[model samples]
Target: MASSFAYDILSNKIETRSAKAGVIGLGYVGLPLAIAIARSGFAVTGFDIDPKKIVSLDAQHSYIDAVANDDLATEMDGGRFSATTDFAGLAACDVIVICVPTPLTKHRDPDLSFVEATSRSIAEHLRAGQLVVLESTTYPGTTDDVVKVILEKTGLKSGTDFFVGFSPEREDPGNQHYHTATIPKVVAGDGPQALALMKGFYGAVVKTVVPVSSNATAEAVKLTENIFRSVNIALVNELKTVYAAMGVDVWEVIEAAKTKPFGYMPFYPGPGLGGHCIPIDPFYLTWKSREYELPTRFIELAGEINSAMPRYVVGKLAEALDMRSGKALSRSRVLVLGLAYKKNVADIRESPSLRLMEIIEERGGKADYHDPHVGEIPSTREYQHLKGRKSVDLTQELLDACDAVLVATDHDNLDYALIANSARLIVDTRNVFARLRLSADHIVKA
Candidate 1:
């Protein structure tokens, strides 16, 4: 039976205040969710443990380029959206969404520390009639196995006193075709009422809501999408290596196959895999499959091939350098162009570009990177004390000075013409030089 507090709020039909929403972990995923909900006429508060992010949001300055500045200003001005680093404020909200990070541990095990910590905070303020939805991408059973246990510690039974649901976020950072409102959402819950309530809540804002059979199904859908990408990308990468041995251009082969217009989708080769999703999500599935005494052979194989790309690129660079003089990589002045993972934007999380830098240094080459969006990339486990490196201007002087230039990422803002004309040697990993219309003699594809 629904509690009096629940009935009272639901009876009024909460045409407005029924949902005082709270969004936890305001990073790439949560920030957008908070903005979308607030814009849909819900009173929303975004919670983040990072004080700097909280301060920036309080000032109505959007840290993420994906969210429009005008929208942030409007939401802040209307009092519909606000942000905080405090956890106690969660008690005031009717619906709480978890969008925390689910990164891998050092040993590639699933790290649920952030998710666990966030749930404990929510448990501290658990109340009746509230609906909790997890928007993080993780293994199946995480919602029930991880979050629900912590919430029930408050003696509140989920799906009875409260509701629980899983709705994995479909966030593409630099994609232009899809926005939060336009993309169809997948939702699943513990029971019919929980499912209906969530569908009703999200339907008000998004264009479509796809209800799955269960929460585990919804979680599996998210993992399957990423695993497919990992497998396909790895397949094409191996083909690139084999086809190159046969003196065939793999990009040309892909372009020809893509013309089929049916049963064929194109995934290009690169220096290596990157971004938070493609490189990491597949391993999550592989990790969970171990519990069932099952091994994801294809997933592990793809990971091996994809992870070795940086080493492969280094060998290609050495071959390109050998054309000039028969010497090793020592004292080689190599300028790396476009250090971000993909093209157009600056997001370096798990970027293969970072691995490229490390490999270059390990091979006795002095590596320097230039990216328009990223001014500085932090030194991590593999790249400690490699800081203070600024993104240099892609001028003629810089291009002409370097012995060789490697195109790792294809940013649209770069002057590819100047690079083709000026650099003594160029190794193109992204196939970006095709757009430059440069002479064939000046470029080498990896």
Candidate 2:
């Protein structure tokens, strides 16, 4: 079959909402995307390696906060959505989307293992007239050089026998203002035909589709967005430390500075960078830059400053414990607040809270945590010893029992007033108590 004929068939299927869509790795990005695609009138089959997720979807239960049970049930009932663990189902779908993780290795280099594995799996069932889009965040040339090469190994040429594109996911978990469909998608493809198919398909689901020149540009778009954030956040984290030494509140400065409205944008400081993107994405570019022998000094500096935050916050905790409570950190009982990277979200991927706990324990301090959103610490690669620890109840007795409270993540649902009245000493990394107008003599901002 000619490439134009295959493109026409897939393009028609996308236009008439007759396309059978398959989404792989149905976790944070995939599940919501699959739901949105299905809601746009396509029959979407979600794929994942986890049987538990398959079972959960089968029972109309939603593991992600953005996806509600009622909405999931409605989709399932309407026969628009289903999930499975079978890669062979890919052969039956006209549009296959990959939404897998692209994590960093221990040395802070790009780990394309997940993306490579997913591409190989798709290649196993790849056929003509199908459009495969990669929504994973990666370095430039990944879609064209890495994923395209893997798929073409099956003797089918992209933009001919099949179409290939890149549309990096801009998933902001727990953001009230934006969801999968509301966020504008940046799409690019191997060729003009593939680009048109990408725009046509994504245009049906999202509110807007931003068509870029090539797959590399789209990949660069995701990296730039994250790198900009990482850099600005590093600046604030540095300023936070500097202002703390001068006894000036960094939060107040940010509040006043953001009021300018024209020139300034606010990026708040936390214990450290967290979630999947800001902490890891900039490093993808930094690692790639090394291949060309170009320097990424600014990016590397930001990463270093952000990476050292847990230790910095822990140092303040120790100082607060010693000065305010007249106790050594080794003998103190510390309550680390919020396990999630950000507030009100249960995602702990690359969260600095894990690092804070590890540092506290390494210093011989007893570390316990309390998060309203996270019930128990899940298994993570870096923090194996901290795994399985349960979130402690936020009772007055529990607060009083602790020597100090370290506010790593300021979840909205937590009782700030109770913490103010009960805890003997508080090291406020998030400045939550001040934001809520609850102040006490013992509260110290880190």
Candidate 3:
């Protein structure tokens, strides 16, 4: 009866759009989520440690391509969305969503510092009759075992004094087809009341809410999706190298295989795995499965191949430079195109492009890069020791000046025609010039 009454009150607040939603960590995931929640008629407050992000959101500017300037202005101007650097400001919020980063440690282990810090902060300000949801991706049992333990230390009982749940963030930055509002939200909670409240909150913002059995179930769902991609991508990358030796184009082969339309899904080959998800998420499970004495061989294998792609690409660069007599990679001036892992985004966390640049520098080769979306490289978690560099302009003179060009990321907006027409040596890792007939004297597919 206590749990039932709690759900009733939470549902009433959500149905009336009177619930105050507070999102911790105003990043690529948090910002869009806050926007969607605000648009759904709830007053949303965004909290972040970075004052720069707070200022940007307050000024009605969006740093993310998925979120537009006009949308930020609408939320801020309409008095539905506001950002803060203070955690104490979340007091009046009925629902608090944690959307902080869950990056891996230097040793490639699960680093839950962000999640732990967020929980501690939330526990500091946790109020009665409020719901707490963790949207940050992490290993299973983190929401129940870790977060629940931390919050209960405040003498507040979960699902009774307060509600707690896990709803994995399904944010795909730069995806034209799906946004936070359109994607189905998967929700689970510690108990019936908490689950119902999670459903009510997310259902108000997103198109649908998929309720699972438990918080751990919801957590595992996210890891499973990324693990599938990571493993498939590794298989494709391994085949890419094998196919190249046999004079077969993996891209062409994929096109024919995908035509079957059933039982086969196509994953592309790239310089390496990049972005926030594939390179990082699967390892979370790998680290956790060890507590059970079980090894995640497929996860480790996929990561091994994906991480080695930069070296593979660098090897190809050396071979490409060898085409010119006396031209060693150690003395080659190479310019890399695109620094973001995927195309048309500014996120460079674990980006293979940077890894490629580092490899070139290590091999005594001069390396520079250009990405229109990313203007200046920031200090990344994985590549902290990496020197920061600004994005170079894709000029004809710049293209012609380099000894060889490596296409690490194939952004659609970039002029491949100009790069192909001007560069003396071209080592295409992403197959950017596949559709276009290139005129470069020496073109090699890595």
Candidate 4:
């Protein structure tokens, strides 16, 4: 009876678009989700610990690329969206979504500190008739084990007093074709009432809501998606090494192999895996599987291959410099082109370009970078020393001064023609020059 009454109140609010939604951790995932909920007619309060983000949002400025300034202005101007740092306001919200970071610790273990901390804050203001959903990617049991355990500590039963659900966030930062609203959302809950509320809430916000059997199933769905990519990418990266030895171009091989169209999907090789998902998500499962005494050999192997790519690219760069210019890398200057993990956006989470730069500097080489998207390097857990470094101006004079120009990221806006014409030696890791049909002796494929 308690569950039914609580469900009725929240369900009606969701249906009528009167439910106040609170999204915690306004970042690449939380910010866009908050805007989407606001756009769908819900009054949304965005909660973040960062005061700078609050200041930016108050000024109608957007830090994420997917959200435009005009859209933010429209939402704020309409009084549908607001940002704050206070947890007391959380008590007023009917629905609370957790979208905090779930990064791995230094030991490659699951770091649930952000999620746990967010849960504790919510628990401080948690009340009856409120729904809490976790969108941070993690192991299958996190929704039930970590989040639910923390929330239930308030002496309130989960299904009867409140609700719990899991819906993994599938955010692609630079994807032009897909956005928060268009992507299909996979949702699951702790019980029937929770599931109904999840379906009602997410159904109104996104285009499609896929209901799964359990919260753990929804969690596994996200892990599987990223693991599939990680394994395939490792396969290609290993193939690149084997094919390079036999005078075979892995890019050409992938371009032709993809022509089959029926049995194959192409995954390209890079300096290494970047972004928050591929490099990190697979390890969440690897860490969880240890409880069951299972060996995730394939996933571990894929991680090794992807992690080794930066060093491999550096080795190739050293080889190219010695063969082409007869100069050892220790006494040479190299310009790294592009800094963001992928092309066209300014997301640098777990970017391999940082590792490449670190390795270059460790080997006694002077390294500088130029990125159109990233103006300066921000503080990161792994690459703290590279912080405050600014992007250099890409000019003929700058290019001419370097011993070798290493192509790390393949952004479309870069002046490849200027690079081909000006740089004395080019070691292409992304095949950007060949893709443009530009041929020169100085440009060597790594």
Cα lDDT listed for each candidate: 0.85, 0.94, 0.89, 0.95
lDDT of 1 at 270: 92
- Candidate 2, 1-446: lDDT as tens digits: 23488999999999999999999999999999999999999999999999999999999999999899999998999999999998999999999999999999888889999999999999999999999999999999999999999999999999889999999999998899999999999999889999999999999999999999999999999999999999999999999999989989999999999999698999999899998999999989998898999999999999999999999999999988888878999998999999999889999999899999999999999999999999999889888898899999999999889999999998888888888999999899887888888888999998
lDDT (C-alpha) at residue 36 in model 4: 100
Q: Write the per-residue lDDT of candidate 4 for residues 40-122, one digit (tens) a residue.
A: 99999999999999999999999999999999999999999999999899999999999999999999999999999999999
Q: Ten-residue segment with the worst summed lDDT in candidate 4?
A: 1-10
Could you arrange the candidates by TM-score from highest to lowest?
4, 2, 3, 1
- Number of the candidate with higher TM-score, 1 or 4: 4
- lDDT winner between 2 and 4, please give it: 4
Best model number under lDDT: 4
Name model 3 segments beyond 4 Å from true.
1-5, 439-441
lDDT of 1: 0.85
Residues 1-446, candidate 3, lDDT per residue (tens digit)?
A: 35455567777998899999999998889999999999999999999999999888878889888789999899889999999999997778989999999998789998898889989999998877889999999999999999999999999899788899999999887789999989999999999888888988999899989999999999999999999999999999999999999999898999899999699998889899988889999999999999999999989999999999999999988987886645898988899988998887888878999889989989999998989988878897556656578888989889767898898888889888777778888888877687676635577788
- Inter-residue clash pairs, candidate 1: none
TM-scores, all candidates, are: 0.96, 0.99, 0.97, 0.99
The residue ranges of model 4 lying beyond 4 angstroms of the native Cα positions read 1-3
